[model samples]
Target: MTMTRRYVQDLQDGETIEEVFLLVDKQLRANRNADLYLLATMRDKTGIINGLMWNVSEESMAQISAGDHVQIKGKVQLYQGSLQVIVTRITKVASDNLDPEDFQPTSSQNVSELLEQLKSRLLGIDDPQLRSLMECFLIDEDLMDSFSRAPAGVKAHHAYQGGLLEHVVRLMEMAWRIGDLYPEVDTNLLLAGVFLHDLGKVREMAFEGAFTYTDEGQLIGHLVIGVEMINEKVAEVEKLTNEPFPVETALRLKHLVLSHHGQYDYGSPKLPMTPEAIALHHLDNFDAKVHEFARSIEDDPNTDSHWTPFSPRLDRKLFKGAN
Candidate 1:
């Protein structure tokens, strides 16, 4: 049967939809009445919508899993100010029947062009040891490919394909301008810190199907993994140069990665200690928060409201006004 697919962004309350979406997440839960229901997050390239399949049989629940592409028949409704799908029927679609592009959300920027800009900016660093350390990562074809494609996060910010590259490049641009404002800030070190701050996210997220955490990501977290990556690369750079990478330089760089989250509760093992580390934290936060705010404004489905609903992450409703 030919089905008219509606993208999540275009879905409206009270509309019946027959669409193919990637089942990005699924869980079976018993409600207060002890009846099992399938709770799922369905996605297409445009966005995600939560789905509830009531009166789901055990066999039906067993047949579907996260990462599967399924054809779903559902009705859209507004739940708690968010759009949700009340799924009535679902069937797994074979891989050959689906187009991969319809499932993944990607950054609007050109991936290759953003990557070149990143490399060109990194090449501007004149500190020999730091440059050599950066080279260790840049030259690895496998790592670069993953780095180019990985998301900055699973959900926090820049959570789309090629988002890591986009986030890093944006941070670097901010760092370059901010670094010049304070003579106390070391431009080369600050830029290096910005470039390497989220390096571990390339490993932390699995993007082959949906953006989800790897076992390593859940267990070790990106900060520690990033520090480990830095140490491994530092060792290689020292071996290649036949000279020890400067101890203080390596320590400072590692510090930046470890403390980029800025606080202990936020997941940083250590708070930002060095000047560069502190600046990296602020710049990273600024970029991520601004993106979240802008995205909230753009993605809000309410056409009549002039203000976005309160964002738990931001703790305030954003006014959509030109003033």
Candidate 2:
């Protein structure tokens, strides 16, 4: 039976809650007086929250693991401008009793509909070689399935399921506008770059249970992985078309993947050198930054405040507008 439960995002300070949450991570820590406490990061579709249980025993830690769906009884409170729960009790919920859907955050966008739009946009590219290259990836059902399910990032912009697809589609929309404005820009190549730049994220991210990096993801990352993925598809395009893929075209596409991050400190292997590459870099940043700011305001638990807490990652507090 389906059940409605209070989600983490709806939690308010001073309110007591008893709800089940996905246990994303947990640590046993010692206080100054040597008392043990359990620090846990919990989630449920809406957002993630931290909970602290004071004077916990070793046996209590044995009751729950990082991926378990556990029932928590706690009081929500604001600490240092952020909200957290002071957990009084926690216990593992029987897996058979609750649906996992209640705990995973999915995209607000429809997956199948967005995918069709994505295919139509890519398939519409007039450049035969580029279209064939995109078809190579699109024809791979397994990869497309992963792409549709993967989050764009673990914590930043579009962190939920299907976020990668959403991010790419939004970029495609922007690419169309930008291409129209700059007639010199190759729209086909720009579209291909947009699709391929983050294709490696399907492999880079492991989203089956918890959103996190795969072992290969931590080692190589999406940029290098993306270049490799494009080469593999490029080979398929050549074999299928019975023609050699253009060397310069392939190199330029790879540049878009490697240089999309835009800077040395941001992990781009090469800086944007081409018109397409520079356009992609700025477009990607513009989308990601705007999403981060919007998400910050939406997820801010401080309803009474006009500004969100200073984000160390973003390095600035977002204005929430006059309340």
Candidate 3:
């Protein structure tokens, strides 16, 4: 493959650049002289850089739109220590030319391997009834296909295809490690909690193109949707076995998954009360925040360090050190 030119961070002052980027946002504007300006967010796998189309022809405005993949020739200039592109020339590329895989961020690990590892862990769960339910979801062909392509969050950690699997696998790993740390906690319960906690996300968030909430998502939300799935699946298991899992035990497991987010504001309608529930809440949030930080690191690799713009997830700036 031919090497594409670098963006502003990769260029020195007075050096020019060319690149392919996803146009995530776009708008036209007026200058003091009422001249036209195009404002947009351009993103590649490495990071996003704000761009401007200053004094461009009216004909150019007719061609560009947000979410269109485009190729641009531009000059790199530093503005207040952040990189900005002053786009001079542009070409709209076929969507296939800018592969979603090339631009969307994903887990920096093999997804299939992670899924296998997750399966192996599930196999080790000792609780027979919980094991059955876990097995059903893990092996459900359709569900596995969706898990393999869905993003865990729209813009946070594991936000690409197969993101849901990656996030769940990571959380399960943590839960298992916690089991090793505290043998008093029932490992089966912990494992079951980890797998089922986010199951509803498959239905809650539509993965048709980009990750966005479905009508169900806006109506029921992931928490409510999730608990309901667990209930439905649990009922399936009961039908197969001709009996129910212990009410108290099943309730505790459901409670952990339901309350893993830890607050109503965070989407957890209930608070985590059991030790397993408490552990899950922290681990899930911990993985998400750490993954997001890792994404921030991937941005502006040439810089020794700089304060990132306010992160909507954290509502603060992050700084990086020399790799």
Q: Best TM-score goes to which candidate? A: 1
Per-model TM against the reference:
0.97, 0.94, 0.77
- List model 2 lDDT by residue over 1-323, tens digit each: 11557888777889988888888888999999999999999988899999999999898789899888888898999997788999999998787877778778999999999999899999999988888899899999999999999999988999999999999999999999877789888888889999989989999989887787889899999999999998898888899999999999999999999999999999998999999999999999999999999999999988888999999989989999886
lDDT of 3 by residue, 1-323 (tens): 23964533455655667777777667788899999898877766555677887887668778877667778877777675557888887777888645676666556689889889889999888878778888777768888777777778766677667788888888888888777788877778888888878877888887654456789988987777777877777788788788876788768877987899998888787999888888888888899889888777565333655666556657777777434
Off by over 4 Å in 3: 1-18, 25-42, 50-67, 72-92, 96-100, 206-209, 306-323
The candidate maximizing lDDT is 2
Q: What lDDT does each candidate get?
A: 0.89, 0.91, 0.76
Window of ten residues with lowest summed lDDT in model 2: 1-10
Give per-residue CA lDDT, model 1, range 37-135, as digits (tens): 999988888998899999887887888888999888989998866799999998888989677998899999999999999998898899988998888
User: Which scores greater on TM-score, model 2 or model 3?
Assistant: 2
By TM-score, highest first, what's the ranking?
A: 1, 2, 3
Q: What is the lDDT of residue 85 in candidate 2?
A: 95
Clash tally, candidates in order: 0, 0, 1
| Cα distance off (Å), candidate 3, residue 82 | 4.9
Which candidate, 1 or 2, would have the higher TM-score against the true structure?
Answer: 1
All models, RMSD in angstroms: 1.4, 2.1, 4.1
For candidate 1, the lDDT comes to: 0.89
